[model samples]
Target: MRREWQVFRVATTYVGTVVGAGFASGQETLRFFAAYGRFGLAGVAVATALFCLFGITVMELGRRLRARTHREVLDHACGPRLGRVMDVAITFFLSATLTVMVAGGGAIFAQQFGAPYALGTLVTALLTGATILAGMRGIMAANSIVVPLLTTAVVFLVATSLHDLGVGPAFSQLAPHPALAPARSWWMAALLYVSYNLALSISVLGPLGAEVGNRRVLLWGGTLGGLTLGLMAAGMTLTVGAHLPEAAVEIPMLYLSRSHSQVVQWFYALILWAEIYTTAVACAYGFAGRLGQLWRYREAVVATICLALAGSGFGFSQLLAFFYPLFGLVALVVLAGLMRRSWRLGS
Candidate 1:
């Protein structure tokens, strides 16, 4: 029973870490895959396979190394010198992730509640900081409740939106939404999507591996988590592809929900905020922890979140357009290194 519960926690945490505001909001889906028209489905499939494989490899390595933080595992994978570089990169990326989520929170609040963007961002920052101050316990609790709710809401929103939006005609039409990702091909987009997300998520996942010792638990837990994330990403891509009316908006999912009904829109708006908060807490915790043992962990987390909140003043789409590709390219290098290292570790 304990083992099963641990598996469930790991899986939910994985999903929660990956399905941030940008993801649930549909902006990330639109840019990374859905914008490719029908070709995006192929990208989604590729991302799914990569996600499963990568998730297994990361957790397995973490468990074997008995790593408490991403730094130890990364060092083992890349060796001291390059691993140090990767650590710095991961820390920066985590900070960037928090910034992106803050911006996403602001977008959600302004879009849904007629609240000021900065106010929304500040609200999310405070919530995320409080949660991170509690350490991993807070993150696990947040993901356990928020991830399930967010996932259920996403599935419902997508299903109902599709029923209203319809898919067949969407595929039949070749209208390219102005908001599609800039990757030249669907494959490139998929690889980039998986790469950057892995780079960002490895923070929490490293600790996750350290928290459990069962090899079967790591394997199945990681695979199932990846599969869940893939399904959500694929479903959102398909839904938004069919209904690209809100492709221009930062929170496409919210836009889609509003199209169906005011009640659904308001409900998902709350979910969007929760999604944003989960990722924000995860990123902030991960980033702050990597900086080493400070006088207090809470102090570290507060500093990190404040930095992110300050940096998040840019608009959501603007940050998505710039950061996802740049960090993605870097993450691919890291992923390749990880694959190479893990191949030998398994051998």
Candidate 2:
């Protein structure tokens, strides 16, 4: 029973770390997979496979190396020279991704509540900075509840939206949307989607693998987590694809939920924002932690919040579209190294 509980906790941690603002809001799925129409569904399949494979490899390597941080794991996977390069890339990407999350918070407020964008951005930044200054314990506790609620809500929204659209028609919409798709090819989009998410997730997952140091536990947990992500992506793709140009908003999940009722929309918007808040806090904390007091962590937190607020002007969708793909492309090198290292680790 205790072992099973450990597996469950690890699986949930994996899922929670990956599912954030863009993801829970359905924006990530919309652009990365749903935009390509039926082909996007195929892309989700490809991404699912990679998520499972790479997730396991990451954990296994973390366990074998007894890595204290993702940097150690990266150093082992890539040579010292290349690993140093990747470390800098990961650190920079951490801030970039946090900026994206802050933007997402503003999108949620403005799009869902008819609130001012600037107000939303400022509020998000303030709240995030406070969370960082106070420490992560509260946010981490909140996430334990938020991730499950957010997951359930996503499944419900997707099911309802698909039923209203008719499942056959939803899946049959073969016309591509392609407005802000990161890649022209569906397969390439899938690759980028997994790559970027893995980049963000590796920070926590690596440390987790070292803490557990159990191959069986990591393998089962990662596989389950990957499969759960794939399921959510598939559901979001179908729902968003069915809605078409109308669903091409900043907060697609809220848009879909509003069709059910204004209350549902409000409910989802709050949940989505909570998830975004947690993610922003996590990102800011992680980025500061990695800096290791080169500056005071609180000062780093303040600086990050200010920078992220400035970047939120680019808009959530635009930032995710541009930066995510770039990060994914660079992170692909780390992924390739992980695969190569895994071969020797297994031996």
Candidate 3:
């Protein structure tokens, strides 16, 4: 019973780490999957399989290597020279992702509440800076509560949308919005989606894996986490597909929830904001921690938050479309190296 509980906790954390601002906002889903129409769901399926395969592989390697950071796992998977290259790339990507999250924060505020975008951006930056200065305890606590709420919110929105549209009609409603899609095809979108998320998640997952007691826990945790993410993605894809043009926004889920009721809108908005906050903190911490005394701790974190706020002006969708795919391409190299290493280990 205790072991099972531990597995669940690990799974929850894994899901939380990946379920960031872009994910909860529904923009990422819309861009990667929903834009493909019904084929998007198939893309979600492909992403699910990849998420499970790589999620477990990463944790398993971390256990074997006793990795304290993603750097260690990268070293074993890519060899020293390539590993150093990846380290710099992923670290830079982490900071860029923080900027994306900040932009997402502003979008949620402006789109959902009609608030000033800069107000939202500054609020998110302040909260993230505080959490980082205080330490990881706040992040863990926030994730514990927010991850479950996010899952429930996604399920609720999907079910409500389907109920309104009816099954056959909803299924028929899906149409490819290629202009909104980040990739050229459904398969490419799915691969890029998983690659970028895995790249971001390894910062937390690698260390978590090293701390776990055994391989069994890592296997179960990774499987459960990957499946949970798939379920959420599928739900978001269906809901957004049913709603079409309305889903074409910076905060699609929040907008969809508002069409149902003000209460639902507020509930989803708060949940989304919380997720955005947690993800921003994780990215800021990872970036600053990696920098290691180029400046004082407070100075480093504050500087990061300020940089992200400045970057947020580019707009959420634009930043996400540009940065995420680029990071995904880099991460794909890391994934290929991991697969080669895994095959050799098997042999």
Candidate 4:
């Protein structure tokens, strides 16, 4: 029973790590699954399965090796020579992801509250950097509080939207654009989405699993996180299908929240900030960890804050658009290598 509870706790943390500003705001869903039209639900299923299977693989691998950081896990998974390559790729992607989260938070603030995006980005960078510098206890404590509130707010908004528009009709309306591919092929879209997210998740999930000190906890935590993401994807699919046009705007989820009440709107804005903070912290931690490993910086915290602030200055939408595809390619390579290693290990 204690183990089961730990599993739930760890899972929430993993879920919180992955479901950052983009997931909370419905922008990621809009860009990935919902963009696929009716087949979007199919994409969601594929993404969920990928999240669960790969998430478990990552956590279990970390548990087996007692990995203290993502570097250890990747080194074991990819072996010495290839692991070096994977390490570089993962670090680069992590930095870009951090930039995206910082930028996304700023965009949400500006779009929803009429604040300057630069101001929002700077504030987000400072808060996230501070939390990470406080150590693992601080990260876990912050996540425990924020994730539940964010999940509840999203559930309320999605549930209310579903009630307004019957599920069947909502899904049916999206049928016209089934199998819409962001890239050249449907398979590529699905693979890119999974690979990109899994690559980024490994840094947080690996160390997180090690911290829990139990394989079962890692398994359950990963499962829970994947399930949460799946449900969020489904909810976003419905919400997007019902009101597709809203997704084109900057703060679609906020627009959805407005339908409920002013209180809900305010609640969601707060939740969005929390979600963004969680993501920024995870990404920054990953980058800082790698940097610390490579250098003898006296003040790692200050260095990380500087890096995040500099990255955030690079416009939000431009950064996301550029990194999203670049990371997808890098991640695909890493995923292929991991799969090959798994095959050999099994054999």
Candidate 5:
């Protein structure tokens, strides 16, 4: 039972690490999947498969390497030269994830709650900074608590939306919103979406994998996590489909929840912030961790938070629209490297 519980915990953390502000806000789903209409759900399937495959590989590699940080995992996969190059690239991408989360908080405040963007940015920074300061255990604890709420909120929204629209009619409502889509086709969107998230998640997975007991725990935890993420994406995609008009907004899911009731809107808004906070913590910690133990802990963290806050000036959608696909390209390189290394090792 204890062993099973641990695996569950690992799965929750993995899901939490990947399902950040972008995912919860409905921004990412809208960009990657919802914009393509019904075909996007097929993209969700593609992403789900990749998420499981890479999630397992990353965790298992972390266990083998006993890696304290994502840097080691990259070094092992790409070897010294190319690994160093990709390491720098991933570190920057993770930092961008932090920036994106910060921007997301501001968007939630502005778009969902009608609050000042600066106020939202400040609150997000403080909360995320506190969590990162608490270290890896802190990120794990936050995920364990927050991810469940996020899951519940998503399920509630999906159910309510489905009740209103019916699955067939709901999907029938979907139309190509090319302006919001990350890619022209669903398959391309799926690859970009998974690549982008895996880039952000390896930071947490790298260390968590090291602490995991065995292959069963790693495989089960990863499969569960990936599936959970895919489920949430599908749920949000349905909600977005039902509310096609609202799908163009920054936080489409929140807009759908609001259509149901004010109470539901308030609930999801809070949950959205929690999602942002957790992902911000992951990104910040990952960025600092990737520095290779060369910087002072307190200073590095504080500086990283400040830089992220500054980067939030990019605004939520602009950053998400541009940086995510760009980083996805870089992550594709890392993913390719990992696959080649795994093939050579015959494991």
Candidate 6:
């Protein structure tokens, strides 16, 4: 029972961490799955399967190697030369992802509460930096409290929105693009989405799996994490599909929740902030860990926080649009290489 609960906690944490600002805001689904139209449902299914399968692979690999950090697990998974490439790609993605989260948090604060974006970004960066500096225990402790609250709030929002939303129209909006109709390929988008998220998540999940000390725990954790993400993706799609035009203002989740109730709106805001903390902590920890390996410069590590804050303060939407797809492609290449290696090993 204790072990099972631990697995649940780990899974929730993993899900909560990866979902972050974009997933909660509905932008991630818009960019990845929702872009597919009705075929987007097919994309969601493919993404779910990849999340489960690759998520398991990542956790199992971590458990087998008893990795203390992503570097060890990635090194084993990709080999030394390719691992170096993976490491650089992951580090870059993490930094960019953190920037996105910080920027998203700022946008949420500004739009939801009339707070200045600069003030919100600065406050979020400082708070998240403090959490990261406290280390893994701090992260786990914070998530223990925040994850459940966020999950509950999201569930409530979904339930309330579903009561009012028309399913027929939502489905109609999801039709595939006419230009891409000939390709008959929803699989690529799904694969790309999962590959990208998993790449960013590996830094957190790999170390988390190693910590659990049990394959069962890792498997269950990964399963829970994947399912949670898929559910969020579906919910975001449904909500956004129902009211596509209203989502143009950025932070679609906020709009969805506000339409339901003021309480729901406030809850969503709090949850969004929590999601920001999760991503920010994960990214900062990963960055610090990587820098500790490459340069051993503590001052440089602190400076990275300032850099992230400044970059994010400029504009969240622009940063997200620029970084996510590019990183998605890089993640696909890394995953393809991993799959090839796994195939050879199996043979």
Candidate 3: residue pairs that collide: none
lDDT tens readout by residue for model 6, 132-167: 777666776777777777777777776677767666
Q: Which is the better candidate, 2 or 3, if ranked by TM-score?
A: 3
Task: Give the TM-score comparing model 3 with the true structure, all chains together.
Answer: 0.91
RMSD of 2: 2.7
Candidate 4 global lDDT: 0.77
Candidate 1, residues 1-347, lDDT tens digits: the string is 58787778888988888888678878778877877887888888899988888887888887788776788877877789988998888888888888988988888788779999999999999999898777777898899999889889989987886676576755664345544666888899889889888888888887878777688888888888889998998788887877665555767787677666788778888988898899988888888886547547767877887898888898776876677789989888778877887677556
Q: What is the TM-score of candidate 5?
A: 0.93
lDDT (Cα) of model 5 = 0.84
Models, CA RMSD each: 2.1, 2.7, 2.4, 2.4, 1.9, 3.0
Writing each residue's lDDT as its tens digit, candidate 5 over 1-347 gives: 47788788889989989998778888788888888888988988889988888888888888888988888888887788888888788888888888988988988888778999988988998888888788877888899899999999999888987988898888888887888776778898898788778867888897888877477888899999999999989888877866776567767777777676788888889999889888888888888775538788877888888898999998987887778788887888778767776554334
Candidate 4, 157-275: lDDT as tens digits: 88888888878878776732333345755456767888887888778777776777776677778788888889888888778766876555666787787767777787798888889
Whole-model lDDT, candidate 2? 0.80
CA shift of 315, model 2, Å: 4.2
1-347, model 2: which lDDT tens digit per residue? 47776677667667777888888878888889988989999999999988888888887877877865578888988889999999899888888888888888887778778998788888887887887676534444555677778888999998888778788987777469767577789999998888888877777678678877788999998898899889999999988888888888877887788778777878888888887877777677667657644787767777788878887888887877678778889988888888787677657
lDDT of each: 0.81, 0.80, 0.83, 0.77, 0.84, 0.74
**Per-candidate TM vs. native?**
0.92, 0.88, 0.91, 0.91, 0.93, 0.89
Model 2 residue 347 distance off true place after TM-score fit, in angstroms: 3.1
lDDT ranking from best candidate downward: 5, 3, 1, 2, 4, 6
How are the candidates ranked when ordered by TM-score, highest leading? 5, 1, 4, 3, 6, 2
Worst 10 residues of 6 by lDDT: 175-184
